[model samples]
Target: MLDISVSAKLKDLVPDFRAGVICYHHIVIADLPQIIAERLPLFYENIRLSLEDHPVSAVEGVKEWRGIFKKAGTDPSRYRPSQEALLRRIGKEGRLHTIHSAVDLNNFFSVQYSIPLGIYDLGHLEEPIRITVGTQEDQYEGLNGRIMNMENKMISADRSGAFGSPIVDSRRTCVTEQTTDALQIVYTRPSTPAEESRRMIKKIAGMFTQIHGGENEWKIIE
Candidate 1:
């Protein structure tokens, strides 16, 4: 169980855009230990083999998703995949180091489903979180302690700080060992058909169920 203060705050932050969307799903999980033990190795191995067989092309579908965000008037740069990062992975034989359990789970799901996911540590967030586009001044510290480039981006944040990327969670709200609960938002571009996106969401949630012993609660938003 989570602290009452944190739980109440999480309840209040559900985004308005998430309402009535038939393609989006938010999944909450309670126990992550079992998830890590059962699924992490399989996910890592599958991702490694998949990348080895059909390596992600930096110039291909990488930018296709960006186009969707661009047409939506969101900053193309914020949503764009880092070409340097992609090339580096290719150069390194497409091997990725597994981070912590929660991070690994999210990364696995992203690679498997070709979708972006953001995980948040419920305890770290302040009450009344809001989902909105970022402004020129909005900034966040990301992986490796680097300041995120949020120029003209969108993010889910609260008075304390941002949690995810323009479409996912920022590192500030990332899960840790002490995390008792989490909220995950699967961002599906408008370009993908609603049915296809929903199917992908279910696949991801199903993986969570297979890994963690719990009944996940989810809702779809437009």
Candidate 2:
């Protein structure tokens, strides 16, 4: 069983933020072989092209700024463009290049479909994991114990704390060799219509199954 927990402080911070302002979703799966075989290469090519043509920006919302600015506190205005931006950029360029299998697969789907995707070790999560918006005082430990600024970021929380991110990931729920099950979370900004976002998610989910060859389960909530 996956052991999980969420910070009460974090949960309290959710409401003031807008839903779908950054369209995001989570996908949980049990294997990776097909992802390696088919999707990896395609994703690599897409990344290469994107890097060549459009210089990679630090994905807007992921960046840090002075305190207490926007109502979301983090300036949702400059937040990174949805995966749609990456895909459109790729289309304008031509083709892209592949990276490590895992990274490549993520970039490929994210760039193609226009959604931010985060994959975490399910084994590390507590069952019935939750998706919630972040709050002001909410914080998670990141690389080197650097506190992850959850202030206004949308997050995937387990029993422990924030595991997935719109900015960065927590060391506790990060993917590792020991990972057996995983949850792939995708975020969509408010600018995207719900219908369009759902369709894009379904298409990407189907592609994930086709390439990875695993039993898949999906859920979407607003």
Candidate 3:
């Protein structure tokens, strides 16, 4: 198992911050299985329907995350949380194309629960992962090879440096078709109950293993 913790500096800034970590190992990754491929459209449709009545920013979960981001020193409007971004995409395009089995599974729950979820390839990370506030020097190549400035942002760092954040994840740790072990981080809102986070993690693990046939374990950190 990987060692993961939240730093005191970040805790002091956002006292209610909580995270759920799911470590899944010995898995096979490939194209989505038939059932998952078939289920995604309907699931995405439900997400679109859920947001039809309100703007994505007006969602209770998004609002809570905006507050958390503001407390953590990042402007929420400038760098929207991943869940909010996904919801907005679904609301606009009505669907998201599949990346791979692992990413698709994480995105499913991220949209369902309105939480930012990131799945990292464990093989690419160093040990002793810590969730802390990024320093001025913290920066990484984000999705699509774009550089993400991590200054003053909440981030998950390994020995290599900041690889993931609620707003965007670094490409270094992004899962690929060759990946077999992964760490999925659930960026739970401060207002979310512990039990709720636990249940969400459990459900994620269940769904992941169901599709990929792996063993997964999870824990919460605050």
Candidate 4:
């Protein structure tokens, strides 16, 4: 298990924050050529029912994230909730991207629970991973070559640098075809129930086992 920490400042800001971590070894993330074909409709129904008649922004999870962004001094509109972004796009487009088993599992958990998750290549991370606030000096590359400056924001970092957070993840630890071990991370805001976080992690672990040939070891670190 990795050593995890939460700062006093972050705890004050998000008192009810809950996190669950799952580390899987001997995992194989397949191309999953048939996964999208078989599961697209299920993903759609999950989102359609949850997002019924409500714009993405008004959903409670999205609203909580917006408040988190505002409190962290970032524009909420600019940094929309990551899961909400995925849900909005999938709900509108009615399609899911093929990123392989690990990535697909991540998105499935995210949409089902209305909480963003990070699936990282476990082999790439250093020990003693932590969660804390980012200062002005902190910066890392995010999705699609975007360099994110983590100022006044909650961040998850290893000894090397920040790799994952609710909003974005660094490219250094992204899961790809060769990945044999993965770390699934779920972060819940104050309004989210601890039970939901637990269920999300459990479900993700179960999927990973069924989809890929792997077993998972999990933890709930504050």
- Model 4: residue 74 alpha-carbon error in angstroms: 3.3
Compose the digit string of candidate 2's lDDT tens values, residues 127-216.
565556576666878633788777666667766666766555687876654444566666554455677767766776666655544545
RMSD (CA, Å), each prediction: 7.3, 7.2, 1.2, 2.3
Error of 3 at 20 (Å): 0.7
Candidate 4: which stretches are off by over 4 Å?
33-36, 45-52
Least accurate 10 contiguous residues by lDDT in model 1:
15-24
Estimate the TM-score for candidate 1: 0.66
List the candidates ranked by lDDT, beginning with the highest: 3, 4, 1, 2
Q: Candidate 3: list runs displaced more than 4 Å.
A: none
lDDT score, candidate 3: 0.89
The residue pairs that clash in candidate 3, if any, are none
* Better candidate by TM-score, 3 or 4: 3
Steric overlap count per candidate: 10, 36, 0, 0
lDDT of 4 by residue, 1-222 (tens): 766777677777766666788888888887664845487677676667666677788877778778876765667677766788887877677656767878877877777677778889989999788877788877899975899988877788888988887788889999998998988887766665677667767777887777778788887877
TM-scores, in order shown? Answer: 0.66, 0.58, 0.96, 0.89
lDDT of 1 by residue, 1-222 (tens): 211112222223322223111111233334456645566556556555665655554334345546544543565554453332433353355444655655666666655545456767666767565545556677877765778756545466677756665354456777765555666666554556667766777776666655543445555553
Q: What is the C-alpha lDDT of each candidate?
A: 0.53, 0.52, 0.89, 0.77
lDDT of 3 by residue, 1-222 (tens): 679999999999998888989898999988888977898898888879878998899998899999999988999999999989999999998998788888888888888888898999999999899999999999999985889989989999999999999889999999998998999998887787788778878888898898888899888988
